[model samples]
Target: MTTRTSPATSGFGIEFLGLPGSGKSTLAGHFIASARQSGLALDTVRAAGRRAMRQRLRRSHARFRTLLTFAAGAAFLRSVYPVSKYEIGAYNRFCILHPELAHAALQAMSLHAADPARQDKAGKLWFKHCLRFQLIREEQGDANHVVAPEGFLQKALSLFGYGAEPTLGLETYLKLAPLPAALAVLRLDPTEAARRLTARPRQTPYPLSSMPPDQQFSTLARWAELQERVAADAASRGVTVIDVPSHRESSEGARILLEQIPEDALCSQGRDKRP
Candidate 1:
């Protein structure tokens, strides 16, 4: 008699969900760097802004092609460029200023005027872009891990609007992806997170013609509310949310996270198979 064996499950994966200046990006950088240094093969998925001209050039054949193309290009550029860096910085500098408006602006850009099909295509493109980058690390024979910031989901939702509840697709992706055995939620106090952001070396120019102060304040309030909602939703799921106090040293935090990885999952002789 022949017996059937179940297929091996895919390795564990993780997603960091949080607002901008919430330390998701910074912690992701730290986590990835530590994993690599510890001889673990890791992959990273970064959500970056694509060049405006390239997007416009691709849609050149559409109806009202010339005018629509320019308008779209201008909007895309505005969403990311001179305005983006400044608007983001200003909002961060004074949380009270136009937070809701800023959040709305971000949401608008995320949901650009693309048909459903085109939007789906964009998501695939983003996934492919991340995969391509992962392949680069693969060539180096490093451990494989994928890291993307919280903004990734927010932006995707803004663009795609996955129905009333939202985040359904994000939840599905997490469940389906072959991630790590342990899911770690790197957390820092809000004050500390803000302080680290302020201390960052690079600074962008703030746009003067931005939304009014009251509008900005409303946006900030909304942003806080959104963060609470995301955290609550994520916790309701089975994700292992880890809070690493900012006062604690980075090395200590990294060590705590490293310890969370299952012992069996560690690459023995740097050749462990996927879980």
Candidate 2:
């Protein structure tokens, strides 16, 4: 089928979103290879991983000072409740600057320490705050036509860790990043997703590894549901959203994802747009 083409603007960007073990990296690899082979004028840019973010913070005096403050708060949290350095760092990187989210993080930790039953609710609220901040950072970048595999959508899925509902965070992220040229959501069965996650080996014992299979299934399902809702909303706004099945071959999924992107989006018009 011939795909409709939109004018290749300098602002074209696409985000590949999915839960862990949902084939995001595999599909992104296939998509990037195909795009390059087809001579598409697009660059595959991986999301700034946590390590990079930490390195950036370590270098900045202003940010480092803020990190120190967060570290102190985290120390207190550790005294009261078990907390992961990774999560505390995420909160510091994303939520420290924002008052609302900072407060939410404290509240979430407090609840997690005092009321185990309400921990999930508090955590989800904190996740929503962090997700909003992360999405804003994504938009703050100067890159155009970015092939982001693990973008803000990952944060949306992560909200499930804090609570059962992921929609509020997902919705807020959309408001920040709005409609991209393409938003390809990788879909998979919750049970299948859990199986995949279980089989995978981790470098370290993280929270995800410790999560129960039932919780994993529920979280993945919620994430997929939110993706569908976001896709529908994007459609109303004229943004293209391609739903790729996790069961499909990565190559085939890449083709479908590419097809949804306008041909003009692949053309480097005049200037050198290399990043």
Candidate 3:
């Protein structure tokens, strides 16, 4: 098969999942620099930056309490998002292609429903402003190497990180979510991660970095355990999993990653074993 190539047409989307302070951002930085210097189409979305913070805030109870603070336009979310405004057609087509996701709650996401599915779809709709944007873009066949710090693969941690044990939903999401061409897991010692998080105390964007040391360690362990399970599930389906270690002296982990998984394979925009 002739592999399609276009700067505007992405061959693939890469997601990096790991514990906080596990050097995902570092590897991503190296990757962005190299890919761009070499002139690869790329867009990197931080795991939980201001954009996500604002999006989550909109869906959170803080919408009212901190409305004046984080509302930055959108008219305090008073803008009525009727079912039509969303990209339902394309999403419907996607369902046509992946009939598996179409059934079950995956069929969910209307303007109104009796239970949590409605809220779930509503939140997903709003959150589309950032990382989810990549999904829509991908569905359009838009080209650009999209790199996510933490996204669909790691969403279980987000859902349950607040203290709810995930049951069926975890497997459902992991099974149904689109498989990226590559899923990279950054591995780092929990103690080192805690040390890094503690050192970066003033970075308000990441709450884990500011949590008490004990809590940070425990949280890191929990995240690691959950992500390992998720990665195993993804790998079982033939998705390439990159295990990136902390950057050692004179060693750029990104280079090793690229070496193991060719750049061409990542930008190909199709799923199969890496060439």
Candidate 4:
């Protein structure tokens, strides 16, 4: 394992997870800027699921999963998404010919659903994505801290993509991917989150865009609920999970979350001192 240390205080890893349009990315940006301004040494990593999955596939030699994930991303990009959105495509897509595939993906998103049967349809992308994220943190040298959005906590909670049943349950995911040092969840009302999604300038592919406005609202609402459940569960496991309600001002939310991270926690005990 690569030792991780932070120049700011002690080395620490922090992640932000939430529904689309819930301002997760925006909040992460604020946190990164603030941390850097405080002279904290860290890396801002985007939770690019397909890319992460691709990396994990390479290492595990999972040839079939690797091909499928790459193929899906290519097909979706070539046939579905618009050009303008490609520049800033934040969410990952799975290629499905039928609208029902999208709907089923949403259905499987229920927190209580049984393990999904169609892992190909939903699980492959999420599982690979999570695996890669774990590898990145584990391999990094201890001198630096990591800041990411939709990272390990989100993946463990099945937030990467909705599945009727998880291919790997939370317990299994935790076993495979160890918990991070700290987690800060950005909370937003489902309705407001939906509104932001609809109002965004770029076009997004399914499952958020697949549903009607009303149905999207419900799905995002469920997202908020599941996030809370995951955070509570993480807290029970002794992982530092802090809920930063970002429904109001995003800056204020970031400020509140910043307060929760201990100064010493940011530095990983000077595990690595190479300047």
Candidate 5:
């Protein structure tokens, strides 16, 4: 099939989002490898593992500075909650100084994390907030295209799917959240996703993981339906939703996925720079 394309005018990020077992990450690996082999300049992180970041933060000098930054940021957040019109403006403009940190903090506030919640809810909310910093920082850099196996789009799925109330700021986030340059969503049906989840060696990631197999499958199906609906909404807001048939052969799926990204987006992200 001939895939349509749109080239973004500036640096942009591409994110892959799908059911936990839908092969989103694996497909991204194949897609990146194919793009590179074909001579496309694709910018990808060499190592995204947690251990790498932990090692960096372990250095005494680095650790002290990092902890200081976190503490300062946290204090800033506490002082401004119940945001006034003026403070909110200040918060927004802080992006001029510390863009990604301000960006993630504001997004978390938009999700109503400033309000009280149960211990579990607070944990989930802040966990996603920390991740938002990474995604925003990477995108803010001078890169033609940065690819994330899972990013804001995927986090939206988790926030929406796991919450007890379906309307709990999800629609608001969907409407106001910063959209990535390209979003690849796995188009597998829930039944297929459930089958793969059950077969995979990794523990299930769903809240229903502890439930019976029948319940788990049903939950996956519901989540899959929500994902499709959310993808449609994102498309309406001008996000390029690359529908990947991940239930098919990974090579074929990756080929189709890469084909959809515009030629301009394939340029090496910061790889052409000469220091």
Candidate 6:
């Protein structure tokens, strides 16, 4: 883990977005490590899921029932928690002030239902849950740096049965989210991403059954779409989008993104107005 001052207070922070195998987390780890060594005030938070599960497991005894209960509690909290309780409270409040944003987000999300590439309704629902989770985290004032995997929207769409059509539309909706101080889209080839994922160090409470073949294919397909979307979106946004090509070394790819962090942006921005 790394520690730094909150960029929110300083009005600085960077968000890294990409697909699962596109190396967002890998790159984020390197960036956080380098930023900390350089003495920058920064904190990293991942969207709730495996990361949240790990956090819960660390605090409680690693019992299956406890984990299940925690998950259920978190989910319930996410939907019912007052908007003010979320980390993305400011953004959510903004949405309330501008209900149109929420409407647009939903519309963008719904457009995916007709997409041809989407086959997994479960995956789409999961993706929506993640989006909500992120919004809630932001509302709660718990997140500063958000590292999103590529094809994040695409994955969500596929999970919900929306295919490529909605997948493309979701890209537009992503831009509507409160803009990060800095946004970096990490790009990589699908083959290279798949290769690296296979070779990368596995971190977790694992079971071969955890990621069965059906799920694996679904995730992989989502990853492929994510790479494509991130590249295109980042280019349009004129954000610091780095393409870590397949031929490049992983360490080198990591270095490319790490180099983009502005020293001033590394500090943590302490608590701000909640939703």
Clashes of each: 21, 0, 7, 16, 0, 41
lDDT by residue for model 4 (147-180), tens: 6665656654444335444442444343333355
Candidate topping TM-score: 5
| Model with the higher lDDT, candidate 1 or 6 | 6
Ranking by TM-score: 5, 3, 4, 2, 6, 1
For model 5 the local lDDT of residue 268 reads 55
Candidate that beats the other on lDDT, 1 or 5, i.e. the better one: 5
Better of 4 and 5 by TM-score: 5
Q: Could you tell me the TM-score of candidate 1?
A: 0.44
Please report the candidate that would top lDDT against the real structure: 5
Question: What do the candidate models score in CA lDDT, each in turn?
Answer: 0.41, 0.54, 0.54, 0.54, 0.57, 0.45
Off by over 4 Å in 6: 1-12, 46-94, 108-164, 171-175, 192-230, 245-251, 270-275
Candidate 5 lDDT over 22-131, as tens digits, reads 88778878887777777665545323323223333344235455666755654675587633233333334434544543344334434533334432553454344434
List TM-scores for all candidates, in order. 0.44, 0.58, 0.60, 0.59, 0.63, 0.50
lDDT of 2 by residue, 1-275 (tens): 12323221223367776766778777877887887777655554434333233444455435446667756755775698664454455556665445443453343244322345455554565554444334334433433445666544443444333443333344444444323556788777777777777777582123456567776566667666766666666555556677886735899988887777764344443334322
Ten-residue stretch with the least lDDT total in model 6: 3-12
Error of 2 at 216 (Å): 2.1
Q: CA shift at 146, candidate 6, in angstroms?
A: 5.5
Give the C-alpha miss distance for residue 130 in model 6, angstroms: 8.5
Q: How does model 6 fare in lDDT? A: 0.45
After superposing candidate 4, which stretches have Cα over 4 Å from the reference? Answer: 1-12, 46-139, 142-144, 156-161, 165-168, 174-176, 201-205, 245-248, 268-275
